[model samples]
Target: MFTPSYHDGVIQHLITDVSEDDFNVAVGGQVEIIGWLYQYYNTEPKDRAFKKKKYLESDIPAVTQLFTPDWIVKYMVENSLGRYWIDVLQAKEDPRSSREIAEDFGWQYFMPEAEQSDQISVQTNADSLSQADIEDVTLIDAAMGSGHILIYAFEVFMQIYEREGYSRRDAAKLIVQKNIYGLDIDTRAFQLAYFSLMMKARGANRRFLTLDIRPNVFDVPESGELTSADFQELLQSEDEAKQLDYLLDQFRYGNEYGSLIQLDKSVDWSMITRISNQELDEGQLSLSSIVLTESQDKLREICAVGKILSRQFTIGAMNPPYMGSGKMDSILGKYVKKHFPNSKSDLFAVFMERLRSLTDTNGYYAMITQHAWMFLSSFEKLRSVLKADTLINMAHLGTRAFEEIGGEVVQSTTFVFKHQTIANYIGTYERLVNFDSQQKKEQAYLAAVKNTDVDYLYRTNQANFAKIPGMPIAYWASANLIHDFEVGTRMDELVDAKVGLQTGDNSKFLRIWYEVDNKKISFRSVNLSESVKSQKKWFPCNKGGAYRKWFGNYDYVINWKNDGHEIKNFNWPNGKQRSVVRNPSYYFREAITWSDITSGSFSLRYREPGSIHDHKGMSAFSKDHELLIMILAILNTPVGDHIFKILNPTVSLEVGNFKSFPVIKNKTIEDKSFNISRKLVQYCKEDWNTFETSWDFTSHPLLTHIADDNLSHCRSPVG
Candidate 1:
């Protein structure tokens, strides 16, 4: 049972190098240090998985491990578990705002409901809740990685027990037994969570650890060889034996999907819950061999997970893993695609749905997840089911909110979700994105809560989201801007916009115009027939370039000889067509174009009559050239910038980003935009022509001003 190597290396390292400093905290005593340590410990594996460009099923936990910040955990729990108790208190005629009650009860992060007059028809979700007695109240962190949320929740449970006049000792045990439940995919995390919880209990009561207490926390196990036949001897009843299949089925991908696994509703776990903890009889214990005992242990553990999963909790506080569908392993990708279609874009959105379902309809669930779900078109279906009024409050914590994650990619929003008392609920939203660092954002949030006019704070009816094009949670969008969609015509209707074609191998069929013979490029060909007649191998292609308006970025030329014979037929080793030749007929058409993506600002430029648009060089075509110019002018204005910001604020501006762009029609060029656009196009073209790279370059503007005879006066008009 003893290994000298373990004692010498592991024991010696800890005894010499580790001490109380590793575990001790200055405030929030007995804090979940395990979560932080786990993150650090997992650095090597996380880096390894990321370096590989793909994740194995076993690496899912390491790859997606996010040690939720302490403040975020508190916010999630306060708004969810804390709000549930406050709702009951308010319903019982406490006559205090939720924030007031929460602060008095030691929950500072809880935001109060907006004050509404009695004239409003909306009702609070409190009326729908079954007021489970204090002991019956339950909370679960389904994806409780290192149990940070659960540890904070423990303190809240202790507070509730004290208010109800229970002894600290009794409350500690009961809290572990009935109040909090957790599940994680990683066993290392589960072990750390277990030790942390035990230490927490021991801190409350010295004798707590001495008792044979097992908190309702379990690491989802790999269902290796978990056949029904294996449990045949362990389970006495025929029905109980058959029920093993359901439990086993739920854990088929346990290594890949932890608490995200939904238990089967068909299985009745009442008897399983009762007999799951049965002690061995004296006769059986003496007679049983190792195999029998192991089987019994496996059955009990499986039943415990099934029982916890099947129960609907009063509250859910979680910081689930974050991974996109593209990065997900095969098993998980297939599971989420079939099971969570609406949220299949990312794992966090999937958990948002899963956790809400695990909660009672009247209960609350709060989480900190990628803010993309709030506005991205991919998650519009997710927002549909969770109606506007379901929102309680949100802290839109955009990028740089994590200590380790320093980029603008991992943006986040933490919020509470529960049905409101009324139809049109006014929810508070704090836009803490402008600030950097976790501490600064937390400070800003506190400041916003204290004073509503903190610039970033806003109180608005969430029902207004439904009036928008795709139900974006644009809490900061002005009322007039939102209403404009009602009277506006979407860009799809006004202009014929397309994403354009893609050459699978840009290197093979593309060349900088000057890189090849000038005579081989068909710069003046207006149509495919004209280009073929010219006997040119290359034609100008409108590839995306720098942000500029009107007549520039005449970048590269594509090999369209014989109607793009090479690009059109480009195939992969798997016999799949690789080159995406979209809108072939629209090739060589005079259209307005723009870079598909930009840093912040947007601009549209004119495409010459003879060019094919690149995939990134998106184009909009119209038979009426004046209408096209008018739209181009409108797009270059501040109005187009505002629309892009409202619709999608991410770095990549997609083709579909403008499909919902509203355009108000005006004929006769009443705004004189048509003429201004024409003049600007000419001015830009002249400026462009003066540059050496331009195909129309005659001479530099500086050269036109000076002549051999007029060296003294230098009076050319261009001067």
Candidate 2:
């Protein structure tokens, strides 16, 4: 009835120009198609947002859009929503476990709890809770990107309602109107979710498209030019006025904050819904009653959003955005820092806490987030909060969990947790980190599920994580390893691991040894004062280089002339000093240093006296030189490699990581280690001296004596 010719021509062009296959996919009746469409549609914007040196708050949806794989969606929904119904049934009459019931319901992705032995430390009361009426059970996805999770949840809810004596058609409509709820900040994401949910319901009920059933999915809208005074004239009570005011102020940034906005849980949204939609008789007709009756006004939008955020869900699931605090703009960073202080390190972590709070007590929250929070020290407080909840299951997808994003930069883990704590609850975990691709990871997870004794599957009590320093979720660690953490001497007690300086402008103050005047460089300065006394412009520096062990990576020289006056005085226009001189006394103290942000095995190399280190090249020192070598030797062992990865599985390792490393004081082993370390260092140094990249390099071994092997001793290998 209302059509504009100009927009109609654009629509005609869209219909005529697009490929038939694309149109077929739109009508494919598969909800997953929407996620794929969104993935490809926002390709350019996502790339642009990521590639820009400077990003804006507007680019959050673009950069964080990830099309969750169908298998992962099934896994998340089958475990959370499916488990909810299963638990309900199990708690009522059926003696079957939640996993067994899920199997009977044909939830293929639901993993059975691993077999725990009698020798286990503690027991749990996992099945002693009551569930809400199946009709009242609801699932909400706060970060419902393209509604992938919500669609799968709809399928689960439909199955539950159907088995509970309702017809498929009625179940579909009920699932849309009552069961599945979703919220997203981005307009495009919200639109896709709305359309996807309708299509999903339409598949189960053929005539659903002609019906007036509205899915409980709303796009978060900002409250623009909205004020409490606008509704004050109609509000009958002061509490209503305050509620309206709170809604307005909370939703001012609703478009940016979305479901993270903590709404007044005390507000009766169901009562508000009834009052707003009630048919007004002639006698009951009044301005105050019409205050919340405006369907198309900002009040309605605010009320709709408030209704979703005001109540906790029986099951909350999402694949929240994965942006580090470093990438966030000041507005988002500070807001998260202020509210979700414990999980302020990343967007996913922040949303984790948000979702947990939005879940009902004794309910469940399921999500797939970057695995950094599972181990990073920055999330210590978050881990502490999680200690109160019981972990149900986990699928550790280390990397390549998403088809769009590749490499080790964004490792992911999917998990489901009960909102209540269960003492010594044994959580099942699928270790898919070794599986390189999505297909391999999925297959590995299923394989681990099928075989209880599979090497990839691990069952552990979450309380054991707290026994270690920083409380890393090292599910694969042995009981002995955990005990070692409690009994063994911490590495911090054995040696002083110090983070070195930041020259700020490495290009200005640093150079390859070959890039500087040889006469101006000092190879041996015992202290910072000696550098100024010797009048050398450049001193050997240990800015972390590529992975190497025992010795070498000594290729750069730093300008430390006159006690680094030029570097220390380097400042911005705001008079903020650019350089950071940390642990200045340890500059030339002969420590073992390791490179930061490494992808390979952890390796600590020996650094000789007279050289300073960089922030990336963290240094560990001991007053006894032999003891330092022994410590380096022990830290470089295969045992150390395993322990270190458990400590901080992410790429970045720092001084703090080493401080928690478990060490035992065994004199015999220490002496043997010291001798072995001494020999290894000598051999590594000799080999390093022959390499062209090494500062000690004199000449190539081939050029030393290739002409006459019998007389090779004459050149002394020139190393």
Candidate 3:
């Protein structure tokens, strides 16, 4: 028999140092140690696959399996499984009594208010349920990873089992057999998850060490040569093919039911062992020989694997892996596109869709995932679906939420939702933002858990999200702002907003005026309405510059020699254009432009008619100059900035972000805004004209004084 006491090199050091007793209490830390080890090993694999534009099959689990912190796991379980019991208790509580009374009666293990009301339908007049009913509830973690969720759930199940008067040993065995279930794609992750749950059970009842008990954690079986050959042989024989067909149908059921395969509830261990022993001598692979176990021990493992197959869980909790569509392998990318067409932009979004399939009716699921799905336009359909569900609670844990993940790697949000969709569900949303360091983030999280009064933490309703165009779950948007989204018209209708031209090679096609010798070529920045060119090699280009409003950022020029024909026609040896030209009509058209990358705030400046715009800046154009000025004024205002931030939570703002913002066009307001913008533009124009850059000037006033020295011709103003 192969003992369960085996450690891979990745976690050998940590596993060897920890005794069984230490491992039980420190399971959370052990999970973290393994998570870091996995991350360390896959760093190179991730980089290699990214460089090669392929996903390394070997590292899929390693790349995705993150050790969800104990607190997050607890929050998910408490809100999900704990809420299920609370729902039963609430339904049984007196209609006139407060929820606090239900908690006081030990009917509710976790606070009801902490989760969404849609999870449980409460009736004060309903019949009371016994403790045995609580133990009957089942739970699973779809992406179980190191089984932290299941391990913690085991603790919760033990509490329920004990409360029902079951012995510790019996409760431990029952919890593994009936309550906890898990599935992970990675075999290594499945092993850790299975071991973690076993350890958890052993802690509850040390007698568990003597029994041939197995935790209901399973992995997708790798198709090997032996299994393939066996299947082929079975298909060739009519009698064997019938058995194969039954098994295949059961496998399909297993997938639909939550198990990776149809697990045999009853196993003839003695016969299985005999067959295994026979197969090994014949140089064939068998389950018993593969695991190197015999008798009831191997049968228990087999039975445990089946327990999760074709089973529905009452609760699901996971911190699903994060991978953007750009990083995904073509196979997974296509699968996501086919199944979850709306949220296929990111792998995390796809997992959000996948999570919906893992729970039973009225089952609750809780996850901490990227907050982008809550607002991005690509996930608009996803939001529409999720909003209909009973969103129990949301904690918007924006950037720097994870300590081990250095810097502001992911802006995260943790939420709990029930499987059922209730029309009148009210969910609580808590905002936790502006944490500069990891310590601050941790402190804020602790305070939120304690339900303490933290200044940054505030609450909102789930219904408020529906008013927004994308149904953005903007928990922080005030009631007034929500109303604005409902009433105002989107800006795309009022202006021609778009990204500018792409000079495929900036180094070859563009230059600062000082970088090249001055000679009349084909470039000039003059009124394009009338044909004009400066007698210089470089013509002005609007490549985005510093944060100044109204005007400026005209320091660049593209070599438009031969009227841009040579630059436009340039191509590489592969027959791909070395230079790209877009929006030819928009070029040299007077417009308002802004840099795509901003310092958390937006600044828009005017680009004159003679300038060619570059991709670094996006532009909004209109023949109605006054209207464009009015739009510019609105964008610079506090309201515009607020809307932009809500539409795009990230620092990077694209043209789509601009289009999403609502335009409040009141003629009276537009007239005044236009006047302010016109004045600002003129002031900026004078500032530009004051310098030697003014093309109309023969020579700089200061230089004129030094060259002439004619006291009479000192009409030049110099102090």
Candidate 4:
């Protein structure tokens, strides 16, 4: 018997208040309300609830669940599923025309270069498959958080069936029974998904519910299915543990071959059908459920659910969860590392591997996930694995891709990669960056879908990527530039690259220029350069400040009087050091420093003697001052910034990324570079001293000169 417990038990509560005219609208509204409630409960204090759990373990699904917007769902479904159907239809014709192509796919065909390829319509020989063969195509949403993607895919499958002369009612039933599959780790999500899919069928035929509809949706593992007694019994028996492991292996194999085999009497349903109570007492294992009944009915239901998920999909779509391995529990982290070492940096990366494996040959896998894998050094191995497949298209959206999420959320990118490794395939990459808001980001995304000519869009071969030092998806690099990376020497070879000290507690040990008691921020009752009678507390510190170049960002003083004893002893509540002090020997040494975080290019500034640099600005020290200035000149150039963008795409300027900078080791070139850099620094210093903000300045340059047309065009802001 089919145990459809979720639809009647949990789903009814979710859609109770959702009474709208349109089906999609009603579902969307319910989801919005559900999401809002989840957010509220997740953020609220649990202490006020009278010693309840600080946060319910069950609420994790709601807290993390992000609704896939309607437009994005359509974009994903159409490109993966819709494109498949279009290719099939095109194959039925003897000769395909641009006009027919324009009429049929003009709205979706954005890549003009790919449009020119005659093979664009010829995805596979299977395109000429009969209607019956097309019906066998399986599509799954691996993460299926409320079944939004699967629901839209249901509508598309209905259209395909309808085109093959099936009525809407029959099409809906067939689509649910054969075409769609969904899996989610969250039971609440599975419940919503099941309810939403059932409602989709109900929308077509009111009498559809009266007939049995086995919607191919299952909650992964169904943690609540087995009782504590059942688990304890299994734990006690080594034979039962081995049997369970074998069952899991069979389940995995079934996913790959389930659809290929017919589910008939030839298969042994005996394990599911026949269960004896004696086996439990005798320490023998069987599929009988301890919680439900000692019969095959419950076992059969679980087996059926397992049968659905054990099949591979022709098309997969999802917005997988965005969590990193660092946030996972130790057990989960260990399992992920062991299973998915190549993509273990983040949960989404692991899903990318899982989704790809779930797809059959020539199948399309499309997802919107954190974009870090494309460029981060840690994910280089994962990128290599992706390079083995065919990249269909990508929409790389920078930070603030999601609404109401800011400050330091992972940036997002939407991409579709096929399981095939076609060498000549050219993928379209639309780089949508610097959008002011989530609304603008969506608008920009839709523009890409419709094939509007916009900036930051390019079409490149997959072979061009993952070839550089850090394996950056250098979609923006020219042919000449890519060649340069292959032959260039890295910067760390020339200079001694080192990050500065981390004071641990800046407020206690450091103070701004204004916060100091004297002209400088001074510690009370402390002596400076010479030894003090009382104590020594204040010292000039070179913490990285604003982005002005050569001379003036000296804005703080640090208390390193006793060799940073207080900071070194400080510990956080987590038992970790509150502050990290590295390379203390390099303190008060002349070096070139730059802000670790900046809005624009990484600006290298010079630091004078008697100043300790902080972690905010990493310092590059050289015994030779001329060599340091040369490195500074190289870093300040547009070429240096362009390379930095390739090494580390994000705003963070890590020493690791800086170490990869290509340097020229020729003495002649170094001398010339040093001379030019010295002149530039002198000019910047002169400009700095001219301003009243400079400690040495007497008057402002603008006050000394009368205003003119030249001054009007280049006016500076007044305080």
TM per prediction: 0.90, 0.90, 0.78, 0.76
Name the lDDT value of residue 448 in candidate 3: 60
**Candidate 3 — which residues are off by over 4 angstroms?**
1-53, 94-132, 224-229, 232-311, 445-461, 502-548, 555-582, 682-719
Candidate 4 lDDT tens digits, 52-132: 332233433544467766566766787777765555665666265433543454334323225436564355655434232
- Candidate 2 residue spans exceeding 4 A from truth: 1-29, 116-131, 236-242, 264-296, 703-719
Give a tens-digit lDDT track for model 2, residues 590-650: 9899998798788889998989988988889888899889998998999999999999988
Where does model 1 exceed 4 Å of error? 1-26, 29-32, 119-130, 233-242, 270-293, 419-421, 531-534, 667-670, 709-719
The models' CA-based lDDT, in order, is 0.80, 0.83, 0.66, 0.67
Q: How well is each residue in 519-633 modelled by candidate 1, as lDDT tens digits? A: 8888998887887798889999998888999668887999998888888789999989999999987889999988876766888898868999989898988878887888888
Against the true structure, candidate 2 reaches a TM-score of 0.90
Scored against the true structure, residue 183 in model 1 reaches a CA lDDT of: 93
Task: Work out how many backbone clashes candidate 3 has.
Answer: 3
| Candidate 4 residue runs with Cα over 4 Å from true position | 1-56, 86-132, 221-241, 245-311, 406-410, 434-455, 513-542, 561-563, 569-579, 663-676, 683-719
Between candidates 2 and 3, which one is better according to TM-score?
2
Give candidate 4's error at residue 200 in angstroms: 1.4
User: In order, what is each prediction's RMSD in angstroms?
Assistant: 4.6, 5.0, 7.0, 8.5
Better of 3 and 4 by TM-score: 3
